[model samples]
Target: MEINDLTAAESRVWRAFHKGEPVAFGEGEAENPATGSDWGPERTVRASVLRALLLSTPQVDGEIPRLRLSGARVTGQLNLMYAVVDHPLHLRYCHFEESPDFYGSRLRQLNLRSSVLPSVSLASTRIDGPLRMTDCRVRGPVKLAGSQIAGALFMDGADITTSDPSVPVIQLHQSVLSDGFAAPGLRVRGEIRLDGATVGGSVNLEGAELSNPGGNALRAQSLEVRADIRARRLRAEGGVDLRGARIAGRLDLMRSRLSNPGGMALRASSCVIGELWLFRSEPLEGTLHLRRSRIDVLSFEPEVAPGEVLFNNLTYTALTPHEPADRRLPLLERDGDGYVPYAYEQLAAAYRHVGDEGAARRVQLAKQRRHRATLPWLGRVWGHLQDTTVGYGFRPLRAAVWLLSLLAAGSIVYALHHPRPLKAAEAPEFNPVFYTLDLLLPVISFGQEGAFAPTGGYQFLSYALILTGWILATTVIAGVSRSVTRQ
Candidate 1:
């Protein structure tokens, strides 16, 4: 390779860097200024010289000297393997003739905004300042595995593509982004990972086009974001995984088209989010699992059909598509093949919060009916009996109704029939009320039913009342227990 000598700007920066002098390069330049003289012919700063400059350069005026080379054609590997330096190297509006290697290096800030570059490695590197790569195009992969970014990592409008389609275009697994990870309109040909990442601010991947077909397009499992996770208008060919992730703010998946037909498209199991907004985005294709996840507000639009999303044990304090009792009817109409009981319970609770007890009861009834469909005939029968008698251990009033009805019938039957005495010496004391009570309470004897020995139809009524009493008592106990446990 023919190596051209450093340009006048490069030479000036080189001298100032060595002398630890504060030389302002590209200060107040156009956002993306065009180069006139420092063009065409590339300059080569060898790996050895680049390493020496990074290691020896001292801070000028109590600040790490900024080496800004804007609109310059830079050609070099710029190898930084195992290099540890606290300095800022900004190459703004530049066109790189060669890629830089920053694997296992510790850099302060690396700003290469509005530049087109080849493959670069930032694996395990510690970038103290923001790694700003806005409006750039990467022809190769950008590796950032196990790396730590102290500030924000912005790649807005950057087109990142790679030759190897199997490999991820941008990887940030186990990386710590202290500020935020924003990539608006970032078009990547492969996967983008932030698994086990800890982001302090919002993660905005709005209008990003990530294509990793039949695989994870964006895997950020167990990611901790203090602010929102806004991925509106994201066109992901594969899927976006946020399983076990904790977002303090809203997880807005508005207008995002994610396709992972067979597998999980968006998994958020055990995730604790402030609000979950899936407005205008229907989960009609793949499974969106939110099992055991807790959110304060869950705003799913009317476009979202049931059975499209699996919400097993997902607890949300509030829900939207807000209307009255019949407002959530569209969601209830879903097939919900994988719907767990807690899903209905949560919905019922949401209705209850809005003081729509009738709607809540309807949800509970529907849940019980659907649950029974999966069970055997015997279970179905038992479920039906419990539902009718005590509203599936939710309404003790139903059990009370049954108890009162049985008592009334027994009293009327005994009042008409004057029963003979069981013992001649004992008077036939049949105060129809006390006598009925004695027969009704199988465990507790009230002494009236014992004194009277009813013949004919009254004898059968006594037996019927005892059985009804036992059933009602059992139902009431179950209902009370369930209420207590729920509380």
Candidate 2:
């Protein structure tokens, strides 16, 4: 790469690299300088020149060695695969003829801010400094899988689209980032995968649009983040899977619009999050599955409820803006999957933890009602009887009322029609109250029941009193047993 053989634009870049000065050919930082297709020699720089300058160029006295070129059309393949460059490369507002390949390469820093790239391949590459690609427009997939970024990865205001919908537009799966992954205002046409990735700091993706209809919009299963995953105002057209993920801080998806019609809008099964904030968001168009997930605090007061919600085995220690059981019971009832007893138990436990015993009891009563719906016809009949009489053991006062009412009815009927004596010599006085009491008490016996005999309709009345007494005893015993076990 002789100076004489270099083009005018390449010569300037070569000269500026040794002096550690940036050569800018663009009009302004906001607008692209390579907008015209007919870029003359002055605005064109061969990729070979850049490769030579990075690998073999010597630094000037009192100056560092770095390639900083702006607003230039890079020709030829800038293949730096397996190359180790110990200096920073800043090529802002540049247009590339081919995708820049940095696979398995190691660099001090790489900044391609506001550039137009066909694609980018940084798989397995190592960057000691931050890899900034803010406001860049990428036409194809950007691969960063298996890469180890020592600093933050900035992708704010970036617009990335891929021709193939099956592949992810931007993939950082299994990659390790020392700092945060900030991608505010990013727009992608395909999935953005961070599956199995470990971020040392928070992942900020505010105002991002991820559209991969009928597929995964953002797949980060098994991801481990030290801080929060803030995706406020995110618009996703497909399911966002966070299954088995571990977030040390809150998963804030406030005001997000998630839609996947027939599939799940958000699937966070088996996830362990410190706080899950899903409040004030648009009504999810699909199911929200939180099966087997654990959260320390949950704020689930959405503007409009999700179409369906699955909360099987979900455990949360606390709920924000705590409402009574009546208000929150609808969320549990939204579980489209078959009856889940554990979901009700968890809600009741949460209410009890907050020192709301009344709310907790209401939740338990609702659980019984829901369980009754799944029983057989005979079992359901028994369930209805228990519920009506004693509230399935939750309302003990109701049992007292039923018992008093039955005693009064039995006494009135016997007083109106008295029973005859079996033998006049041994018969006691015809006291209606004592006679009814003898028939009502199952284990207790009075001399009146042994001496007197009810005839005709009076006999049927005696039989009815005996049967009613036994039923009341049995139901009371069952209700008391249930309450004791629950306590």
Candidate 3:
């Protein structure tokens, strides 16, 4: 029904709503209006009155059982600023031809369940209550700058298309996004921004297609989040940037595809991340920088395609010697295969930071060998070991263990072979007459067996044993040293 066809009473109600005033209609009050057709004008007036009331009040209690604005076309803006309501704002299958601004509007408590908005704009809107826009289609730009949302903002099976290429489909600037902001299986034609924003909860943009020809598909700058930022199966034709971001929780970008000619950066400068979970992500062509960042854990799929991943001056806080030895070496090896030296370099730095110079030297030597160049002077000891003919698996404690065992074995052999017998023939002439010189001599001889022995046979055996022990000790030491140095 057009605005001109309404009766005098209906016209008055519509004008009051357009002027931003509160209006209420009782049960069947529209059935007997003073002007126009009783049912037609009555229903129109009733709907207008309810819409105005909802827009004006801070909260709406009680229920208007059956109010319908189905398939209605709003020609002008539908501003719902600072309005709170307990009842649902049901506007299913509605169309807005022009821009409908809902800036600074607060929904205290109510679910926007299954509401359809073909085209709408909500810049700087605050929703303190639960909101659900399942199966909604937004054709225009959805600006959400400097907004504070308390409850869950779900947009399941939604489509956010951009009418203009220059405008972003979902713009979130310096906003506090708590709870969940999900848009699974959605198609977004323009870019999505969460720049300088803080998210207290998770953001799931799974199976979403973000395509922007001239702009970044997903850009999040200096973003801080408490929960995970999951974007699995997301396809971005443009680049994805998360520079200077911090995630206290996990970052799951599994099975996603990011392609851009300008390059995509996931830099986390001076930021602390919990876990970088990138499993089965497609071959990314851009650089992933994590300089001066701290990560508790990092995981990646071994079979995934190679990409340029850089980790310079990064600190792995959760790396411990007691952790499974097999888990510590794979990332470095894979990084070596991918032609990225920063991984090995950063691992070496981690060892050096923890006062493990031996391990650090080993890592440096490995890098030198992989690159086939002369190692630095500080890595000479490790470099010499790496060039040895025999290769052993890299381990630092193995050398110490082998050296101690050889020493213990040699001592036992020396003690077992040498034996001295006591004699009483030559005794000290006047020394108490109790202590005999023969007994003293035997004790002294036993104490200095190999040192003072005059017989060549004993000396030869002692030397042979010493040589053999030295050979074994040197061999084991060499193996361990080489293993660590080769990287």
Candidate 4:
């Protein structure tokens, strides 16, 4: 169709395309040119055929085909605004050196699959049906702001590169992205995802969402998304900030790597997250978890809670071997006044692993104090004994108590068996020195030995005292042994 030979309506649509205005279709505006009839099965079939032919053609610069409604090479800038096409809008193998504007237009369908456009602007464009693009290369910025996509938007296996740091490869701001938005394995040299884009439906990016995961070569600010963002492998050189984002369902980022100096923060203060899986991801240089994230309560097992913060199996290199004690960062610190019982337990375990028994015991004591109401008296005693320093201080007192107990027991036994040196009968003539020696001998031996005597009554009394003293000594030793073993 020659530009001047076109009908008035066709020329108007062409002018709108050049002006980059969104195409608005009225009734009967998309009638078939061959039969002069509205769009139907026959028109749809013809459009599909023409679209395939257009895709097959080898596109070159300044090559416009002369066939009516022909598909030819589209170089420089191709504007297709508000123009109604009875068939699919196919732009295959076309390279736009400058920006290609396709604002507001009514078409049966739009398929830019396998096309290369440096900068494509489709602002406020309305598609009655689906928009599919696969393996297309977008070298510059691709803006789809305020566009309404009734059907799905598929951009699978597309390479989008942008040199500007401020502009994203694909921008979808305030647009009604419905049904679904899928871009699996879509590589964006710059930021690939949207900033405040709202997907009225689901988003599937499985095995995609990677931005230089190997080393700290590439650095990004964040992957911001207001909608429920689901991906299997989301990697970034910087942190992943999902603050104030509401995800109605689960947010899965399994096997992802978030490398940032301050670590990552998946903060969802009031957002409803069905389930969040941050398993097997690389550690951030700082804290791995966040402060206020309302994760699913039921999804977590007893070993792990919803609000519980975990930083397990992470290896950190010390900035300096002999760094100042004050400057050294702790593996974990109790900041908030929440459930500190679990925090203390974890701290104790870490200390124990590092062979700091003293610190471990101190942590245990702090835990006891926090939960003393739940523990038994014996548990309290055990806590005290676990402290080596405190236990040492009480050893001497314990020994003294043991010795006193033994002396008391011995006194009782001797009192119960003593026989009055009665009736030394007939006040026998006694040597004062010999009597004194006999008395001193029994006292010095602590009544543990019998006196030498020929009389039967004297020998019996002496043997009883020796037997009682031996029994008392054994009882004392047994008591001491039991006390030490119990501790």
Candidate 5:
């Protein structure tokens, strides 16, 4: 406001503000008309404003003036904190010696494209319009915690960094954005935090580099995005945490590389989302935890290794049928240590809901096979025996086949040997077929096996037949019960 403190360029802007015309900092280019050695030239202007110029700057003819700092280098610390700025601040190809403080300020619009700055801290601020900082070079951290933006926020191809790379370079904790937040090809040296943030529009972070080795590269817990949150081709060195976040649209992580072995690359526990597309050429490395999450469609066509992702209690409503579930069965095929029966069951049910019974039964059968494989040596043998004998009590007719075989062997042996009859009183009356049936049927008291008195190997043979009959009967009963219960 003081005349003595105002530089030559600031004086021109002050005059322009009084006359209500378009205003800007620095100077415009001129022809080579002045030639003087005594007076040198100044390329960029340097000035400082102590007070807020909120109402003093008038709009000429009811039209806002452009404050273009085209190819200008702004000097000194611009303290516009908590100040209501209405005009559009467009600073292009400029350099700021000190970072501006815009805390809790209501700005109409702000543009800092292709510029360099120390840092940008707009915590708890409210912006009424768009914020464009494309391809800018920010040296320090950019913090926008608890801020609200009415329009889109763009930082595409921007080079944002800090001295310490471990710290979060871009923070938007608990902020709300009316439009999309895009940052394609952004190279940030540290983590990007969007914890508890809500975006009404989509968020596109394609080809962005988020690196914070061994820690979270992007912590967006409980974030609610109304639209899609796409990060295709994202190369995250550290892990990306999205625990309990909800996305209305697709969560497409196709071709993205997230690596954090033995730890979570992306922990999305209990998140409710739409279709999840993860079809990638390279195998997804790390533990992708999706426990208790519900997704409409799961397109996991990646070549994931065992223990690479933990799908404990993950449930999906639908599965996109890109190929037959046979070839795509590898998604559920994991190592013995990482086998989850419920997860398999959930997938099977999803397949069944889509009327793909073949795929459903395949998943169920796989669950059984993998489960048996994970057991001890004795258990696997028992399972195999049950499967062959009665099909794990799923096929009761197998028991009848064993019984008939036993009967035939007994009759053949008796007919060929012509063993002594049961009483020896009526040897001719004793029928070999009747005798075999008596030994085989435990419930029927035919009086042949009881009355018969045989010695040597024949006596042992009768006892074996009785034991075999009893075992077969028990197996049949079990098989019936199992079949009914499954139905």
Candidate 6:
């Protein structure tokens, strides 16, 4: 490009690039009225001239060749597909007539802070330094899929909206960032996909509002983050998918409002996270599916108990709030998958880990009750008998109480009417207490049950006592065996 062909603004930009200076047409404020739409050729720079300067211009010996233009109106599409730009590009507070295409480009650094563009395509692009688009507003998608950034990606306070509902507003799938992705206070009207992405540092998404109704607001399946994911107070309308995501640090969703009606609000199944902080101010409006996921610590203290949850096979070492088993049992009861023994067993193990043996037993007891509900009618009836008689082997004192009550009743009945002796020569004494003990104790014989025989009503009474003793003995043995097997 010849210097004589440059427009007034383009000439200033060209000179500034060679001299390593930023061309500022208006106040640095993003909403400065001087940089409004009424600007003429004096503030306009053609994209072709800017591209030429970045690609063909020779670098000065003493200065860096950078395109640092601010508060300017770019007229054409700055297509730099597959271009390798060594200079840092900074286009702050600028307005673009067409979206810039940087697909497969390798750049030293890229900053579009507070700029307004129709869209941006940086798919498969590689950045040596940070990619900063803080406070920028894009009307269409910002494609960054398969991109590799050596530095952090910042989009703080940016508003990225899209008319197309099927596509994501910001695509970071398969992207790798060394310093992580920060997007606090971001407002996105479509999905932000980070599937298969790897972030070296933490992801900070505080106070972001993502609205893609009836679809995924944030789809981050299989994302591997070396650090934490701080998403406190995030308001997502559609849902969030963190399935198979592996985070080294905490995934904090404290005070976040996630709603998708009947659908799952957060699907984090098969994930391996260090800690999950879900202490919300309000209850989750939809189901939270964490099936087959493993976490170190689960902080689940919601203001209201969640209604639907799918936590089958979820394994967590610890639980927050240190609540009793009763308080935590409600959460297991709300499992949408229904009668998941693994979930209950995991909770019991968690309680045991904290040295809460009583709570652990309570959890196991609840597990039995939950499992009983799914059994057949006869099985349930038998379960009820075991529950009432022995508290399903959890409360051993109940068995003792039943034994003592039956023993007392038998002793009183036999004391009122003594049975005839089988042989007068062999009979010792008719002690009702000893006789009742001999009848109840199935394993041992006191030599009195065989020595004596009952007649008429006494015979009927003896038969009833024998039957009752056998039933109680059989139930006790069954309960003991079940408890032993579980241990």
lDDT of each: 0.76, 0.88, 0.57, 0.47, 0.73, 0.88
TM-scores of all predicted structures:
0.74, 0.92, 0.61, 0.48, 0.80, 0.95
lDDT at position 12, candidate 3:
50
lDDT of 4 by residue, 142-183 (tens): 778778788878888877777775665676655666667887
Worst 10 residues of 4 by lDDT: 297-306
Candidate 3 residue lDDT tens string, 1-487? 4557665655654554433343333332222112222224333333444445455433323423222333333334566655444334544443444455567776553333233344554556677755565566677677777877787777767777777878768787688877768778778888888888888888788898888754688888788888888888988888777777888887777888777654553445567788776667886655566666788875555333244555556667534432232344454554413444766666666666666766666765566566543447666554555444222234435544543554455445445543332332432222211112112222223223322332356456546544544444454566666546645
The per-residue C-alpha lDDT of model 5 at residue 3 equals 57
Among these predicted structures, which one has the highest TM-score?
6
Off by over 4 Å in 4: 1-72, 81-87, 104-108, 212-229, 263-270, 284-289, 297-487
Instruction: Point out the higher-scoring one by lDDT: 3 or 5.
Output: 5
lDDT of 4: 0.47
Error of 6 at 102 (Å): 0.3
Model 5 C-alpha lDDT per residue in residues 234-317, reported as the tens digit of each score: 888777898899999988778888776767777887898997777772465677778889898887664543355567778888
**What TM-score, to 2 decimals, does candidate 3 have?**
0.61
lDDT of each residue in 386-442, candidate 1, tens digit only: 888888766777777777787788788778886787786876556888888887776
- Candidate numbers sorted by TM-score from highest down: 6, 2, 5, 1, 3, 4
Worst 10 residues of 3 by lDDT: 431-440
lDDT of 5: 0.73
Instruction: List clash counts for every candidate, in order.
Output: 0, 0, 0, 5, 1, 0
After superposition on all C-alphas, the RMSD of every candidate to the true structure, in Å, is 5.5, 2.6, 11.3, 16.7, 5.6, 1.9
TM-score of 5: 0.80
Q: Which stretches of candidate 6 lie over 4 Å from their true place?
A: 30-35, 302-305, 482-487
Better of 1 and 5 by TM-score: 5
